[model samples]
Target: MRLKLLAAIGLAATLYSCDDTTTGIGDFVADTDEITASAQTFEATTKTLKYTDLNPNGVFSRTSNAYLGKFTDPDFGTYTTDFITQINCTEDFEFPETMQDIVSTTLELSYSSFFGDSLAPMRVRVDMLNREIDDDGEDLGLYYTSYNPEDFYNKNEEALAEQDYAVRDNSWTKEEIDSIKKANGYYPPLVIDLDKARKAKGEETFSAFLKRKYNEDKKNFKDSYSFIHNVLPGFYVHNTSGEGSILYIGAIWLRMKVSYLIESSSGKVDSLVYTSIPFAATNEVYMSTRLSNSGDNLEKLAAETHNTYLKTPAGLCTEVKLPLKEMYEALGNDTLNSVSMAFTKYKNISENSANNPYKMGTPKNLLLIRKSEVNDFFEQKQNYDSKTSFLGTYSSTTNSYSFSQVNRLISQIFSDMRTKEEPAEGWDEYNTLVLIPVKTETDSQGNTIGLSHDLEVNSAKLVGGEDGEKIKMEVIYTKPKFNK
Candidate 1:
C-alpha cells in the first residue's frame, strides 16, 4: 500500500515538474496509484582494444605529457614506451660559430610525477629521426603503436645523445608546489649534453647550422620546417634498460649553449657570450606505447566474478547496456526524477607491496560514454556533461564508482518519449555505455577542462559480476499524467 502511495506521489511530482495539467491524485485514488523507483543490476562485457585503435594523437596536454619506462608485470605482461618530439628554435639568432665557442649543451626534460621504483636506475637513449614525418604521417610520428624505432633512424648508426633519468624525483602535487615558499622547488630540470650532436652529424651540427642561418645566404636552415629538412628530423627517447619505473615526462626540449665571439661596433673586441638555441614548442611531438606481451586480458579478469574492467594504454574497457526501452514502456505518462549507478572496485591485495606498477595505481576515476560517441570522445577530446556525458571519481575508501547523474539522464529520456513516438534520438539510441579508464586534465584552479586516455599506461579492475550486488542502477520515476 505504501509503495503504491509513493508511486502516486512521485507521479504527481513528475507531472508538476513537466508542467502537465492532469497528473494530480483524485479523492478516490488508492495507494496503488503511487509510482516508485527501482534498482536494477546488469552484467557488463569487458574487451581488449588494439594499439592501432587507441587514437593516441593529442591525447596528452603540455602539462601532463607521456610516460617513459619499461615494466614487466607477472600478470599484465611487459609494457614499454618510446617518446619522439620535435623542437624548433625560437628567437632566431644570426651568428657564426666555431667548435671552440660551443660551451655547455643540454637536453632538458621537466616532469610532474612518476610511477614505479624511484631508486631503480633507468637508461634512456635519444636518437635523431632522419626521415621527414609528422603526427599526420601514415606511418611516422602519429604512427601505429607497433612502430619500430629502426624504421625512422638506426640507433646503431645515429646515436646523437642519451640520458639516465630518475623517475622518482621529489615530485609534489600542483597545489603543494604552488604553496611552496621557495622559488625553485618544482620538478628538477633534466639537462643532458647535446654538444656532441653538432660534431656527430658532420657539418649538420646545430652550431654550423646556426652559423649558416646567422651568416651566409641561408636557403635551407631559415625556418623550423626548413631546419628539420636540412639537418635532422627529430629526436626519439626510449628505454634501454631497467623495468624499474615509468616517468611522466611533462615537457621536453633540446638546449644548445654555444659560446660565440660577438664583435663590438668599436675596434675593441667584446668578451664571448653564450647564445642558447632551443628546439621547443614550435614543432610537433608524439609518443608511442608497446604492450610487449599478451598480459592485456580485461575480459579474463571478469570471468573470475562476471564483472567488467577498464584498463589503459590500449588495454581494456567495460560495456554497460541499460534496458531503457523496457523502462520507458513501464513509465507510461510519468516522468523520471533521476537515475544513477555505482560500480564497485576490486582491491588488488597482492599489489599492496611497495611495487613499481603498484606505485602508480590505476585510474582514480572513469568515464561512462555512449557507444556511438566513444570514437569522437577520445579522438576529439571531449568532456563530461551531466546530460549525455558522465564521469565518476573512485574513492578507495568507498570502494565504488558512484555516478549521481543517472536520474537526470533518465528524466531526459522520459521527456523524449513524450515528444516523439518510436525509436527516440540521441542518447536514447545508445543502450550501451562504455566505462573507459581516463585521466582528466584540469586547470591550476582545479576545474577540469578536458579528458584524456591511454596516455598514462595504467590499468584497473572493477566489479561487474552477476548474482551479487555488483553494478547497481537506481531509477526514480513517476507515472504519466492523464488529461482532465
Candidate 2:
C-alpha cells in the first residue's frame, strides 16, 4: 500500500513537471485518473473492413513534365505532352558589344530523371511558339489532361535543335562538355546547336535572329515580359517520333555566344560575350492522353475484394469505404485518440512480361484523402495529413504501405458533428477515400509545396478485402462520462 501511494505521487509530480503551468493538483489528478480508468475499460481491437471507397471518375491534373513527349504506355494508353515556357533572368541580359559576326548560339537542357524505356530511341523537335504567354507565373493558367499542343505553336522556323535521345544523356564530347560547364557552370545532357545559315524558306536562323535583336529589339532584353512578347515567343518541345519513353526536363538555358571587334580604351580588340535566358519567367505544361487499356483492368476492379489496384498518371485509384455509422454506435461519446491501418501490395506476374513491357510496378508513395477533394488537391498539389489526407510509401521488406492516423481523421469527423450538419449517418462531409499515386514537389527548404497529378507514369496492385490480414484499422479512444 505504501509503495503504491509513492508511485502515484511520483507520476503526479512528473506530470506537473512536464506541464509546468498547472495551478492545482486536484484537477490534474482527476484528469489522469479518468484517463487511467478509460484505458482500463476500453480495449483496442483491430477492425478489418472498407472505411474508404474509391468511386468512378477520379480527378486528373494538367501537364506536369517539362519535355513533352508522345508515348504509348501499354496500360495507361497514349499521351502527348509538351512544355511551353518563357525564359528570364534575375538581372538584365548583357548583349555583345559589337554585332559583327555570329559565332555560335546554342540552347541546352539538363535533366536528372526520365520515365519509360531507355533502350528505345526517341527524337525531340523544338520550334518557336507563335502565341504569347502571360509574363506572370503567379498562375500558369488553366491546363487539363485533354489540351492540344498544336493550338499553341505556329511551327515556324525549321527545328532549332533536334537530338536523338534516350533516358541517359551521354552524347557529348569531353571538350564540348567542359566548355559548356565552364560557360554555364552546369553540364546539360541535351544540346541543340542552332544553325548559322538561314532556312529553306529564307527565314533568319536562331543566331542571326538574336544578332538582329541585339541591334533592333534591344528593348526585349530589358525585362522578361518584353523578351517573351516583343522579341521572342515561348518555344514548344515535342516528340516527333517515339512511343515508349518520357523525359523529365529540369532546367533550360537559351544562350547566345558571339564574337565581335570593338575599339576600346586600348586599341581595336576582338571581344567575346554571352547572353543567357532561362525559361522560368512563365511556363505551362500541356498534357493530352489517349487511354486505351485502362478500361480492361477497371472491369475486373469492379468487384470489391482483397485485390485492388492503383494506377498512375491519373489512371485509377483504390477506394475505401469505412463503416462510420457503425464506429459511432460502438464508441459513442468517447475521446478519440487515433486511427491507423496498413495496406499491402501483392504479387502480379504480368508486371514485367510483354503485356506490361514497361515493367511498371507500385508507386513509391500513396495518398489517402477525402473523395470529393481529389480535384482541388491535385490541381493545387496538397499534402497528405491527418485532417484530410495521408501519404505512405511501399516497404519492400514488408511489401506494404502503413497508414496510422485514424484517430486524427475520426476526431475531425466528430468535430464536424457539433455543427448539426446533415450527416451521411456518421460522417459530416466525407466517408469514402481513394488512394492516388502522385508526383510530389517540394520547396527549396525541403518542405512539400504541392503535388503534380499530370504524368501517367506509375501503377500498382494492392491486397485488400477480408482475406488480407494487414488490411485493417485500429482506433484508440477514451470512454465518455457516465450519469449516475
Q: Highest lDDT among the candidates is held by which one?
A: 1
RMSD of each: 6.5, 7.3
Error of 2 at 177 (Å): 10
Tens-place lDDT per residue, model 2, 126-196, is: 77777766634354233444345566676665666676766545666668767776886555557667563
TM-scores for candidates 1 onward, in order? 0.74, 0.73
Q: After superposition, how far is residue 393 of candidate 1 from its true place, in Å?
A: 1.5
Quick one: RMSD of model 1? 6.5
Question: In model 2, what is the error at residue 192, expressed in angstroms?
Answer: 2.6
Q: Give me the runs in candidate 2 sitting further than 4 Å from their true place.
A: 1-31, 34-67, 70-75, 135-141, 155-163, 168-188, 194-201, 262-266, 270-306, 349-358, 380-385, 418-429, 440-451, 454-456, 465-470, 480-484
Clashes (candidate 1): 18
